[model samples]
Target: MMDARHDHPKLVLPPPTYPAVLFVMAWVLDQHLIPPFIDSVSSAPLLGAILVILGLGAAGWAVLRFMRAGTHVEPHKPTLAMVMDGPFRFSRNPIYASFFALFAGVGMIMKLEWTIVFLPILWLCLRLWVIAPEEAFLSSRFGSEYEHYRQKVRRWL
Candidate 1:
């Protein structure tokens, strides 16, 4: 059998690991070093909860589409098909976008200014380390189809 690693995208780390690390680091930094900057908004928690729910919904929709397409949801596995329905129709990287939303929401909820401040870094990491390699793999695997999709859809909305 072919080596499983060879079948997957060349990735620096698992896709979810980036956000997970960001979340923890943001929390730790907030607890130990960084102080909250944004003034307490009375509605912050409600807005944060809404964002979290929306992020979860979007991610769930994307995962469901992948399941229906018979494609592996994990980035470390080879994709069986290109999913273009549901949230994919809007953003090519909906799940990653959802991660950003989740990060923002959690930051707001926990009053972690570090999380909000470091969002750009999270985005950069996803764009370069995660999404870039995944796109490369998809472009190679699906060729014209992926290229067309890339042209049609924004990477993130």
Candidate 2:
């Protein structure tokens, strides 16, 4: 099949790609926006590290669940089944939640105030451009089964 992403190239960035591109943007922003922190880093640097690890773990688990279900992990493709086990027990979008957590963790650990500032734009893009389409696709493909699961699980925890 022709790739679904080809149709809306500008709007539909995959969630995993966001941090890679935006981290560089955040670094550039940090250079012009603030003096390097001469002060010592905070305790939450460790907490931030933990969050990054946890976020990756969660995303990985969600992907594993999709693989186990024989469902396509990429939302652009039609999924074979609705995955409700693993991390899906809590959030409808564990992978996206992981992205948010990872982004926040990086900002906190790097002490880049501007990262936090632009975080919401990244979030809006993910929700509107990325996840929204995926959710709509699932709703259409899976119908009532997907909707009932959506009602049970919050989007993010």
Candidate 3:
């Protein structure tokens, strides 16, 4: 058997731990990035709260699955198993999606008017900086198994 650790794929991007910091910084700066003319929050208060609840719930669900499977949660490490249960069943990138929901939720909760633009930027960063590289790593390491999972689940819900 080919041990996963014996031939770990060469990761092209830096580990995601630092990007999380960048995300937080960007999250704060996002409020300032919006054009004064365009800054506006959604009128619906309940929707924001709901998004927060759902995002947190999904993140917790993914984390629980990861813990139960005994896989490393760090992006720098290669996961030993492909998880297909819990929130993962609904979205391949549940964590990222949850992050998005959380960001949007925070915006909604704070009524950060700039989030209309901020959310898309966050999504773009996560997709390009995080998800794309992650997908490539999974493909290189897991081969057809990852591909099969990719086919089975949407990258995001």
Candidate 4:
């Protein structure tokens, strides 16, 4: 049976809040939690800083790839074509996944246990709010083609 929720399109913007929230949370944790924890774990501030930069670079690359793929038919709307090449081939939502990974990498480098604690929260937010809706929209729009792609590729590998 068709789920009624599928009748409506997915909310794409709100899902992005997870990353923003994580960013703020990471900052807070770094300022507060990491210092206290630093007594037990040796600090690698330099290495951590490097990882944060690298992670941002990776996430930026994914975003650039998405923009270069195509111009949207509607200026403010989603692109019509399914981008299956580049980073998209590895993960359906490379941008979002990359952001998540970047957050994780940043948290790890900063040694913020509290930020790490929010990783699962970020994942849950993406899964329930963003991914679920995007999946529904794509499935509704592409049907079997999307199903085939979903079957072949992991959501965020």
Worst 10 residues of 2 by lDDT: 2-11
Q: Rank by lDDT, descending?
A: 1, 2, 3, 4
Cα lDDT of all candidates, in order? 0.87, 0.77, 0.71, 0.67
lDDT of 3 at 49: 87
lDDT of 2: 0.77
Which model, 1 or 2, shows the larger lDDT?
1
TM-scores, each model vs. reference: 0.93, 0.84, 0.76, 0.73
Cand. 4 TM to true fold: 0.73
Residue range with the least summed lDDT across 10 consecutive positions in model 4: 71-80
Local distance difference test, candidate 1: 0.87
* Tens-digit lDDT string for candidate 1 (40-150): 686777788888999999999999999999999998787778999999999999999999889999888887778887899999999899988998888978889999999
- Model 1 scores a TM of 0.93
Name the regions of candidate 1 deviating beyond 4 angstroms.
1-5
Please list all clashing residue pairs in model 3, or write none if there are none.
Answer: none
> Model 2 residue 147 lDDT?
91
Off by over 4 Å in 3: 1-43
